[model samples]
Structure formats: structure tokens, C-alpha cells
Target chain A: MREVFHQSLEDVQSRLVEIAELVTVAIERATKAFGTSDVTLAEEVIEADQVIDDKAIELDELAIQILARQQPVARDLRIVVAALRVSASLERMGDIAEHIAQLTRMRFPERAIPKGLKSTFTKMGEIDVQVANLLTEILRTEDLALVEKLRTLDDQLDDLHLSVFEKVLSENWQGEAGATVDATLASRYHERFADHALSVAKKVAYLATGEWTPDTDSIAVIVAADLAAVRENADGAEA
Target chain B: MREVFHQSLEDVQSRLVEIAELVTVAIERATKAFGTSDVTLAEEVIEADQVIDDKAIELDELAIQILARQQPVARDLRIVVAALRVSASLERMGDIAEHIAQLTRMRFPERAIPKGLKSTFTKMGEIDVQVANLLTEILRTEDLALVEKLRTLDDQLDDLHLSVFEKVLSENWQGEAGATVDATLASRYHERFADHALSVAKKVAYLATGEWTPDTDSIAVIVAADLAAVRENADGAEA
Candidate 1:
């Protein structure tokens, strides 16, 4: 029974890594699509999201079955429970990618990157793809060091996200309402993609570190802080 | 052992209800604060979110303990697992409220609700509060009927969300980039609050109804469809 349970735990881990890989691909393609107005590539990301969703559901079922049959206790139980959460977060990351793709498709033949903020969004997308890759590595290897790297990447994404707002809200900005809206939503999607990856990285870190922290440092705090800092800077600039 | 396990499950249920009640209050205050630009009320919501977070963590610990001790299987195990997911969604609902409060506070001395969209945001806020209340009721009573009502309210919120985008993207929109950003983020927050409640409501409904669906009809699909429909209408207007 002990050996069987260990094997099941391995299964959960591999499956998580698998789903993370799929999310990585989804974000990579979605970001590329958004940058180039490649509607075909965007459509691929939109369609492939279902596979990620299906894999997450399968993983969840496996976790539930392990609980029902193996009845893992103590740390083993926490591992299974955390798999459920990691699966949920990975699934959300896929959805964020799909949302970015949808944004690309919605503005097909018209650049979704907006007129003046193209380079800003391009950087955000590249960072998001990097974050997804790092997340997959963490899930696969359980390298806790990657967790810090992931957080740093997420912070960079947050700064770029802020820069987006700064660009749009500046007096010299000349984009129309559609451009502003696209930039706002697209920047948000890119930032949230990294945020979810960071969250999953934290969970993996907890599993490796045995800290059992329950997401006290949530995305809301980071978002609020980012916004507050940007607003203060904007105020200072005007002064 | 059986009796103790049953008792533990009841404790989980009641604790879920308790957390849901707190979420209801958070959203109620948050939406109110947003509409009024009441910085103090926003501060109250922000400060109280930590309590909600702490409760969620406590609930998670309890659930983990139940899994460790009771080792429930089949439907019983799924119940505890569902509690964890529901707790997460409720906690996220609280975070969304905090986000709205942050927006309110961020724009203090200047109204957060952009001009000409006051009535729309008011309706969205009211529906979000209603969704939170119904979600709490569903958690408390397992009343599947309320789930339908919750979906209806979510639909209303979705329409309002799309309408905000429409108004912002239209030719007549006169709000500056700051107002546009605020409206975009605030509307997204309001819409997501309801979405989280609807998600929790679905899990409760599944538990009560014995259907094992695993979020196949995700928020991604709904959002994609919403954006598609709105863009179609916008394109038609241009044509």
C-alpha cells in the first residue's frame, strides 16, 4: 500500500507538470498571435484551451480517486489537496491565454497591440511566456529556486502592466477608446497570466518547503500596491 | 468514528456558510463604497478582507484535518474536497470586493463611477450583492433552485459588463483615459465577483444534485461568447 500510494503521488506530480506544459504552449502561441495579428494562431490557442481544461479535470479526478482509495494522511493528504489547487490555477492560466487569443481574434486585421503601446504589450507577452515556462520547470523539477525567479518575472509584468495604464492615461496619448480598452484588457490578461503562474509556483514552493502557507500574499495585494504606486507617481508627475 | 466524521462534515458546512456570510457583507459594502466613493467605507472593506482570508485559511486547515482524520471516501471525500474549492471561490469573492474598495479609495475625492455610466454600474453592483446573498443561501441550504436564480443574476451582470465596454468603445464616449481605465477595471471586478459566486453556486448544486461535472462550462467560455457577441454588434453598428 505504501508503494502504491507513492506511485499515485508521482502520477499526480507528472500530471501537474503535463498540464503546466500545455499552459506554457498556450501562452506562447497566444502571445505570439496577439503580437502579429495572426488570427489562425490565435484560433489554435482558443481551441486547444479545451484540452487543457480536460486534462485538469482528469487530474482532479485522479486526485479524488487517490483520496478515496489510498486515503493519504498527513503530508501525503496535503500533497493531493495542493494538486487540486495547482490544477485549478493552471486551468485558469490557460483560460487567460485563451482570453488573450480572443482579444486578438476580436480585433483581427486590426492590431490588438494598440497603436503606440505595441512595444509595451510585446514585452508583457514575452514576459508572460517566460513566466509560463519557468512555472512548468518548477512543477517538473520541484526546484524551489525557480519560485523566486517566477516572482521576479511577475513583478516585471506588474510594472509593465502599470506602464500600460500610464501610457494610456498620459496627456500626450492619442489612442481612441477602442485602443485604450484593448490595451487595458490585454495588459490585464497578460498580468493575470503571470499572476496565476506565480501563485502556482508558490504552491509548489510550499509543497517542497513544507511551509503550508495558504496564499496570504495574494494577487489582490500585489495589484492594489501596483495601482497605488502608479497613481502616486502620476500625481507627482503632475505636481 | 462514523459519528465523529459526520460531525466534522457538519462543521465544515457551517464554516462554509460563515465564510459566505462574510463575503456577502464585503461585496455589499464594497459596491456601496464604490458608488459613493466613500473612502472610509472602502477602507473598512479592505481592512476586513484579512479576516475573510484568515477564515478561509482556517477552513482549509479544518478540511485538511478532516481528510487526515476521517479519511472519508467516495461522496464523503468529494464533499470535503468541494468545501476546499468553495472556500477558495468565497475567498476570491472577498478579494474582488477588496479590489472594488481599492478602486474606490484610489479615486477618492473623484467619483470612481465614470460619468454617464452611473446607472449601469449601480445596477451591476446591486446584482453582485444579490448574487453574493444567493450564494450564501445556496451554501447554507443547498437549495438548487437558488442556483438558477444566481445564474440569472450572473447573466444580468454579464450584460452590464458588456454594455460598459460598448459605452466606452462608442463614438460618444467623452471620458478621459483615467475614467476609462477605472470603468474597465471596476466593471471587470463587479462581473468577476458574480462569476465567482456563480462558480461556488454550481459546486453546491452539484453536491446536492449528484452530478459530477467539473466546470466544463467555465467562465472562459462565457466570457469568450460575451466578447464575441458584443464585438459582432459593434461591427454591425459600424457597417
Candidate 2:
């Protein structure tokens, strides 16, 4: 029975890693589509979402089965629960990537985004890659120190988001409607991507600390930067 | 040990319901402030958030302890895991309410929002109350049906958010800057509140189905409505 339980646990972990890998690929493909306006790549990202979704369901079932069979206690139980939460976060990340891909498909063929905003999208893609890397590290080592590093990375994403907004609202760009739409969508995708990354970090923190911390400082900093960016943009418009 | 686990579970449930109550109150207060431009009421919502945050952490720890001690299997394990996710969603709801209150404070003394948007805000408040009630039912009965009902109510909130944006971008609203700020913040708060409600519903679904189905049709509907509203508003402005 113990051997069976151990085997099931390992199976669930491996499946989770597989789902994470799919999510990373989805992010990469979605961002590539965004940068190149490749509708075919976007379609691929959308089509591949089912695999991630199915794997997430498989992991949940495995976790439930392990709990029912082994009745894991203490640390073992925490590990199972953490795996469930992390899987959900990863699933959400996949969903966000699909969302970005869908937006790309909708706004394509027109080259709606200007050159300036392309760099913003590129920045977002970089952040998405960082988030994917963080998930890999957490799964590989379950190390809290590596998870702690997500805070600074999340802050950088926030800064890039604010800068994107500032550039969108400025007169140098003629405030084109297409530009605004691209900027808004790009900002939202980055913000939400960072949010999922933070969710993963929170799960890792729980594994390490045995307690859940809200980590509001990161959000506060984002909000503060948002307010400052809006103010600066408004002033620039007035001038 | 079983008795202790049961008691802790009960404690966590009670606190969850309490937090739900606070979320409803904060939503009500923030909406009222939006209607009347009452800074004092908004301030109350902001101040009350600390209590919500504290309870969230406390309940999270209690749930973890219960899991560690009881090593609950199957349904029991699902219930504990659901509780943890629900608490996180509730905490996020509290944060959204506080965010709206902050917006109210920022727009004070001059009434940034016009009278035309009051009905829409009131409708959003109604949806908020419904979501809170749905969560309370979830805790009381663990009824999957009632939780499913929340998905529709979330759509209603999204509809209300669309109308708010329509009013903002319409020519009838000559004061573009303040209206834009008010509408942006209002839409964000409403959308986020609905998102949290959906998160709670997802937890209930997992508890019932043992599968992460990611039923987001309701959100898709809401997003479609937003796109239509934005288009109509822009067209009307051009006319």
C-alpha cells in the first residue's frame, strides 16, 4: 500500500510538471504570435489548451486518490494540497495565455499596434518567460528562497506595465484607438500574468512557512506606480 | 484528535461566513459612497479591510492545521481544500471593495461620477450581495447548485460594468478626464469582485466534481458585452 501511494504521488508530480511545460509552450507561442501577428501560431496555442486542461484534471484526480488511499499526514498531506493549488495556478496561467492569443487573432491583419507598443509586448513576453522559469524552479526544488525572488520580478513587470500605459496616453503617439487597445490589452495581460506568478509564489511560501501571507506590498507598489503614471500622463496631455 | 479537527473546521467555517458578511457590507458601503459621494462611508470600508485580511490569514492557518492533524480523506479533504481557496477569494473580494472605497476618497468633494451612473452602480451592488449570499450558502450546505448560480450573477455584474463604460465614453459626459478615471476604477472594482465570486464558485465546483472544469463561459459573455459597449460608445462619439 505504501509503495502504491508513493507511486501515485510521483505520478501526480510528473503530470504537474508536464502541465507546466505545456503552459510555458503556450505562453511562448502566444507571445510569438503577438509579436509576429502569426494567426496560425495563435490558433495552435488555442488548440493546445485542451491538453493543459486535461492534465490539470488528471492531477486533481491523482491527488484525491492519494489522499483517499494513503491518508497522508503532516508534511505529506501539505505537499499534496500544495500540489493541487499550484496546478490550479498553472492552469490559470495557461488560460491567460490563451486569452492573449485570442486577442491577437481578433486584432490581427491590421497591424493595430504601433512600433513603441511592440517593445511593451516584448517586455511582457520576457516577464512571461521569467514566470515560467520561476514555476520550473519551484517544482524542481520546492525551494522557498527561489520563490522569494518572484517579488522583485513581479515589481519589474509592474514598472513595465506603467510605462506602457504612460506611453499610450502620451500625445507623441497621437492617441490612436488601435494603439490604446493594444496598450490596454498588453498591460492587462502582463498584470494578470504577474498575479498568477505571485499565486505560485504564495503556494511555495505556504510550503515553506506553513502559513499563507497576503504579500500586499507588491500590489501596493503596482497601484502606486499606476497612479503616478496616470498623473504624469494626464499632465503631459494638458501640456 | 477527530473532535479537535471538527472544531477547527467549524471555526474556519464561521470565520469564512464572517468574512463574507464583511465583504457584503463593504460592497454596500462602497456603492453607497459612489452614489452619494460619501467619503466617510468609503473610509469605513477601507478601515474594515484590516479585519478581513487578519481573518483570512488566521483561517488559512487553521485549515492547514486541520489538514495536518486529521489527514482528512476524500470529501473531508475536499472540504478543507475548498475552504482554503474560498478564503483567498474572499480576501480578494475585500481588497476590491477597499479599492473602490479608495477611488471614492480620491474623487471626493466634487462628485467625480455623474448621477446617470447611479442605477448601474446600484445594480452592481445587487450582484455583489447575491455573490455574498451564494458564498454563505456554499459554507452552510456545500450546495453545488447554488454555487453554480453564482456564475450567472457574475455575468450580471459584468453587464453592469459594460453599461458603466458606455456612459463614460458617451458624448453626454463632456468632462472626459474625471469620467474616465471614475469609469476605469468602477469597472475594475466590479470586474474584480465578479472574478472573486467566480473563484469561489470554482472551489465549490472542485469540491463537488473533483475536477477542475474551468467553466468560464460566463466571463466570456461579459467580455463580449464590454467589447460591444466600447464599440457603440466610440461610434456614438464619432457621430
Candidate 3:
């Protein structure tokens, strides 16, 4: 019975990694579509999200079955619960990717790229890649220190997001509707992507520390304050 | 043992409802501060959010303890998990309310109110109240059908949000930077509040159906398409 339970545990972990891989592709495809204005790629990302969703449901059922049958204890139980949350974070990440894709599709053909925002957008894209990499690391290594690092990495994304808005507003380019919309949406997508990544980090942190301090508000505050400062600076310039 | 376990479950549910109430008050306070430029109320919301966060952590630990000690099964397990998610959502909702307060405090004292946007802002406020009500309903009754109805109600909030952007853009009342910032932040808060409520609904649905659909994209498409139609209709008036 113990051997069978261990095998089931192994199966659950492998399936979770599979779902994570699907989510990674979804993020990559969605970010690529946003950067390149590739509507077809964006649509593909949107369609493929359903697969990740399906996998999450399947994994949840599997975990519940294992819990019911084997009744995992202590650390093993934590692993099962962590699997549930990781799947949830991956699913939310997939949803954010779909949101980005939808935004791309909405502003298509004309390709409303924000002016002087390319580097900022590219930086956000890099941050997103970092998040995906960290998720993979968490899954494979279960490194508590690395998971702790994600909180700071999320802060970095917050800082980049501020720069994106500041660069847009400070240039006195407010009249360009398309550019403004693109910048706003891009920043939102990046922020949410980082948030979902942080959710994964928090799960790992909980597993390691057995204490849950999600730190969502701190990240939100950092991002909000940065944006507020930019807007204030813009107001001063206008005055 | 079972009686003690059931009583703990009841205690957890009561705390969850209390947290929900606090969040609802926070949302109201924050919105009022936004409308009236009341910094004190904004500060009050910010301070209250910490208590909400503490409650969330407490409830999570309590649920985990119950699960560890009681070894609940099937329906009981679902209830515990749903309680965890509800606590998380309430905490996130509190964060958003605090975010709105922060934006209000930062942008106020300048006191630039948008002339024609008050009605729209008020409408967003109403939507927020509806979201709060839905959350209360979810907690009080746990009715699956009512939870499903929240998706449709979320569609209404999305409509109000698009209308906000259209009104701001059409009027070209872009000079009042503070008001524009306020409107933008207000709209964002409303949208996020609805999103979190939808998340709670999804959790409830999952608990009841034992099936998770991950239909965020489908719902987004519906909302986006509806917004597009509204925009098209508004454009026709200009033409």
C-alpha cells in the first residue's frame, strides 16, 4: 500500500510539472503575440489555455483521490496541498496570458505600439520569463531560498512597471490613444503575471516555513505608489 | 471528536463572514474617500486592511489544523478548502480596497473632480456594492446557482467599466490630470473587485460541482465583445 501511494505521489508531481509546462508555453506565446502583434499566435494561446484548465481539473481530482485512498500524512499531505495551489497559480497565469492575447487581438491590424515604451515592454517580458523560470525551479528544486527570492523579483517587476508609466506620462504624449492603451494594458498584464508567479512563490514559502504571509498587498502597494509618483510628477510638469 | 470538528468548522465559517463584512466596509470607505476626497476615511480603510490580513492568516491556520486533526472527508474537505479560498479572496478584496484608498490619498488635496464622470463613478460604486452582496450571499447560503449568476452580474460591471473609458475619451476632458487619475483608479478598483468576487464564485462552483471549468477566457470574451458593441454604438452617434 505504501508503494502504491508513493507511486501515486510520483504521478501527481509529474502531472503538475506537465501543467506547469503548458502554462509556460501559454505565457511565452501570449507575450510573443503581444510583442509582435501576432494575432494568430495570440488566438492560439487563448485556445490552448483550455488545455491547461482541463489539466488542472484532472490533477485536482487525482490529488483528492490520493487523499481519500492513501490518506497522506504531514509532509506528504503538504505536498498534495501544494500541488493544488501550484495548479491554481498556473491556471491563473494561463488566464492572464489569455487576457494579454485578448488585448492583442483587440488592438490588432493597426498594431497600436506605445511610443518609447518598447524597452519597458521588453523588460516586462524579461521579468515574465524570469517568473516562468522561477516556477520551474520551484517545481524541480523546491528550493526555499529561491522561492524567497521571488518576493524580491516581484518587487523588481513592480519597479519596472513604474518606469513604464513614468516614461509614457512624462513625455507629454497623452494624446496618442493607442499608445496609452497599449502601455496601460501591457503594464497590467505584466503586473498580473508577476502576481501569479508570486502566488507560486508563496505556496513554496508556505511549504518551507509552514507560515503563510502571501505579501500580495506589499507588492500592490509598491506598484501603486510608484504609479502615483509618476502621475504626480506629470502633474507638476503640466502645472 | 466529530462534534468538536464540526464546531470548529462553524467557528471558521463565522470568522470568514466577519472578515467579509470588514472587507465590505473597507470597500465602501475607500470609495467614499475617493468621491469626497476624504483622506481620513482613506486612512481608516488602510488601517482596517491589516486586521483583515491577520484574520485571513488565522483562518488559514485554523482550517489546516482542522484538516490535520479531524481528517475530514468528501463534503467536509470541500467545505474546508472553500473556506480557505474564501478567506484568500476576502483578503485580496481588502487589499484592492486599500489600494483604492492609497490612490485617493495620493491624488487628493489637489481636489480635481471630473465634471461628467460622477454618474459613471457612482455606477461603478453600485456594482461594487453588488459584488459585496454576492460575496455575502455566497457565504451565507453557499447556493451554487446564485454563485453561477455572479458571472452574468460581472458582465454588467464590465459594461460600466468600458463606458467609463469611452466617456473619458470622448469628452477629451484630459486636462484635469487628478480627476483622470481618480477615474482610472476608480474604474480599476471596481473591475478588480468584481474579478475577485467572480473568483469566490468559481471556488463555490468548484466546491459544489466538483468540476472546475477555468472559463475566465470565455467570460472575458463575452464581456469584451459586449464592450465593443457599446463602443460601436457610441461611435455611431458621433458619425
Candidate 4:
């Protein structure tokens, strides 16, 4: 029974990595479509998002079953709970990718990205795909080494997102209100996509580190989580 | 032991409703400050957000303890899981409200919203507060009758959100990129706030009904949830 439980746990982990791969492909295709106004690629990305959704649902049920069967405690329990969260995050990442694709499909032929900002979008798209790749890698290997790199990537995206804003709101800007809106929303999508990737990595970090974050900043969150865990253990003993 | 478990479960449920109420007040003050350009109120909302965060973390730890201790299955497990999701959604709702207030803070004394859309935003704000109130009520009463009201409220917010986009994109628009971006993001915050409330409602409905939703459109999601639950049950029995 113990071996079986671990097998099911392994299955859940692999399923999460699989979903991360699909999410990576979705973001890659969706961003490629965004940069080139490739409506066909955009359509494909949109249609394929259903697969990610189905995988998430399947992974969720598997995790729930494991919980019911083993009633795991401590790190094992955290791992299963984190699996559910990672699946949801990946599913949301896919949905965001689909939304980006929809934006591409909406402006098809006309180009969702304007001419002046194409290179910027190109940069953002490249960085976003890289972030997505990092997500897949980290999920696959559970490597803490890759965790710090995601924050750097997310910081890069934030800088790029802000630059997009500055360019649009610059004194010499000539784009219409519509283009400005498009640029703003699209930049936000890519930035948030990176944010979600970073979020998943943080969850994995917590799982590996055996901590529960009580806040956003890593140091403070870890310290607070440790305090909370100690307090909870005392409470549990008392109860 | 059963009595202790039931007591703990009730404690978890009440904590969730408490978080919901805090979310309610946060949205109310944030939107109120947005309309009036009341920077003080906006600042208050922003500062008060940490309390919501602390409460959510507290609620989550409590739920995790219940799960680890009780090892609940079926409906009881669903309720605990739903509480976690609800706390998350409420926390997110608070964050969005904080974003709205931060916008007000960023554009203080200048009124982040334009005069033309004031009435529209006013209407939207009223509905958002109503939606927030409904969230508090449903979390408290678990009254499925209020469930229908949330969909209606969400539709209202959606309609208002669309109108904001339409007005900004219309030919008469004179606002610069800054105001346009502000309008776009602020409207989205409100729309998403309502969206989260509706989501918590759907989760509660599933808990009440023992369904497993595949998506967010309540009726269709509920139907799909039912089918998924049936399939999962068959899979469990077969296993």
C-alpha cells in the first residue's frame, strides 16, 4: 500500500509536468502568433487549450484520490496540496495563453501588435516563452536552482511591461487610442503570464523547502510561514 | 472525536464568512474612494488590505489543520477544499480592490475616472458592492436562492465593463492614453472582483450539490460538474 501510494504520487507529479509542457507549447504558439499576426497558429492555440483543461481536471481527481487513500501528513500532504495548486496555476496559464491567442485572432490580418512596438512585443514574446520553458523545466525536475532564475525572468518582463507603457505614453507617441489600448492589454497579458510562472515556481519552492508562505516577499514569507507552522504544531499538541 | 471534528468544521466555515465580509468592506471603501477621488479613503483601503491577507492566511491554516486531522471524504472533504478556494478567491478580490485604490492613489486629486463615465462607474460600483454583499450572505447562509442573484450581478458588471470599453474606443473619446489605460484597468478590476464572487458562489453550489465543475459558467459548469462527478464515481468503484 505504501508503494502504491508513492506510485500514485509519482503519477500526479508527472501529470503536472505534462500539463506544464502543454502550457509551454500553448504560450509559444500563442506568442508566435501575436508577433506575426498568424491567425492560424492563434486558432490552433485556442483550440488546444481544452487539452490543458482536461489534464488539469484529471490531475486534480488523482490528487484527491491520493489524499483519500493515504491521508498523508507533513511533507507528503504539502506535496499533494501543492500539486493541486500547480495544476490550477498551469490551467490558468493556459487560459491566459488562449486569451492572448484570441486577441491575435481578433486583430488578424490587421496585426494585433502595431508597427513601432513589434520589436518590443518580439522581445516580450521571447522572454515570455523562455519563462514558460523554465516553468516546464522546474516542474519536471523540481530544481530549486531554476527558481531564482524565474524571478529574474519575471523582473525582466516587468521592466519590459513598464517600457511598453512608457513608449505608449511617451510625448512623441502617435498611435490611436485603440492601439494604445491593445498594447496596454497585451503587455499586461504577457507580464501576468510570467507572474503565474513565477507563482508556480514559488509553490514548488515551498514544497521543497517545507515552508508555508504567509506573505509575498520570499524572506518575509518564509520566516512568517515558519512561525505559523511552529504555532500550529503547538496548537495541535494542545488540542 | 466526531463532535470535535464537527466543531472544527463549523469554525472553518465561519472563518471563511468572516474573510468574505472583510473583502466586502474592502471593495466598498475602494470603490467609494475611486468615485470621489478620496485619497484618504483610498489609502485606508490599501493599508487595511494587510489585515485581509493575515485573515486569509489564518483561515487557510485552519482549513489545512481540519483536513489533516479529520481526513474527511466525499462531501466533508469537498467543503474543506471549497473553503480553501473561497479564501483564495476572497484574498484575490481584496488584492484587486487594493489595485483599484492604488490607482486612485497614483492619480490622486486628479480623479482617476473621467467625468463622462462617472455615472457608469457609479452604477458598476453599486452592483459590485451588491455582489460583494451577496458573497458575504451566501457564505453565511449557504442559501442557493442567492446563487441566481450572483449571476445576474455578474452579468450587470460584464455589461458595464463592455460599455466602458465601448465608450473609450468610441469616436468622441478625448482622453489621452493615460486615462484610457486607467479606465481600462479599473473597469477590469471591478469586473474581476464580481467574477471572483460569482466563482465562490459556484464553488459553494457544487459543495451543496456534490458536483465537480469543469469551468466557470454556472449552469453549464454545474451540468458538466455533475457528469464529471458521475464519471469519477464510476472510476472509483471500478478501481
Of 1 and 3, which scores higher on TM-score?
1
Per-residue accuracy of model 4 over A1-239 as CA lDDT, tens digit each: 88998898889889998999999999999999998889999989888989999999888888778878788877788788778778878988898888788778766567889658988889988998999899989988989999899889888877777667667656556887667777877888888898788889988988888665443533222322333344344335546
Cα deviation at A32, candidate 1, in Å, is 0.4
The candidates' DockQ values read 0.65, 0.31, 0.40, 0.20
Q: Which candidate is the best by TM-score?
A: 1
Per-residue accuracy of model 2 over A1-239 as CA lDDT, tens digit each: 77887787778777777787888888988888878889889879877887887788778778777876687877677788778877878888888888777766655664535567777778778778778877777776678887768777877877787676566555565544434544665576767787887887787777678786765634743464466557555766788
**TM-score, chain A, per candidate?**
0.93, 0.89, 0.91, 0.88
lDDT of 1 by residue, B23-125 (tens): 9899999999999989999999999999999999999999999998888987899899999999999988898999899888888888989999999999999
Which residue segments of model 1 deviate by more than 4 Å?
A: A217-239, B214-239
Q: What are the per-residue Cα lDDT tens digits for candidate 3 across B1-239? A: 88898899889888988888888888888878877879889889988899999998899778778777777888888788778777878888998889878877776675423567777777777678777877877877778878767777787878877777676555354544345445655676788788888888787777777787554556567655654565555556668
Native-to-model Cα distance after best TM-score fit, residue A170 in candidate 3, in Å: 1.4
The better candidate by lDDT, 2 or 4, is 4
Please write out the lDDT profile of model 2 over residues B1-239, one tens digit for every residue. 77877787788778888888888888888777866789899889888888888888788778877766677876787787778778878888988888777767766665746557767777787788678777777766778878668878876777777666566555565533334545655776777687887777777677678776564534643464466557555766687
> How accurate locally, in lDDT, is each candidate?
0.87, 0.73, 0.76, 0.80
Relative to the true structure, candidate 3 has a C-alpha RMSD (angstroms) of 2.8
Taking chain B only, the TM-score of every model is 0.94, 0.87, 0.86, 0.89
Q: Residue A206 error for model 2, in Å?
A: 4.5
Q: Which candidate achieves the best lDDT against the true structure?
A: 1
What's the candidate order when arranged by decreasing TM-score?
Answer: 1, 3, 4, 2
- In CAPRI terms, model 2 is classed as acceptable
lDDT of 1 by residue, A1-239 (tens): 99999999999999999999999899999999999999999999999999999999899999999999998888799899999999999999998999899889888778878888888988998899899889989988999988889989988988888888878877778888778888888998999898788778878888787875466545656666667677777777778
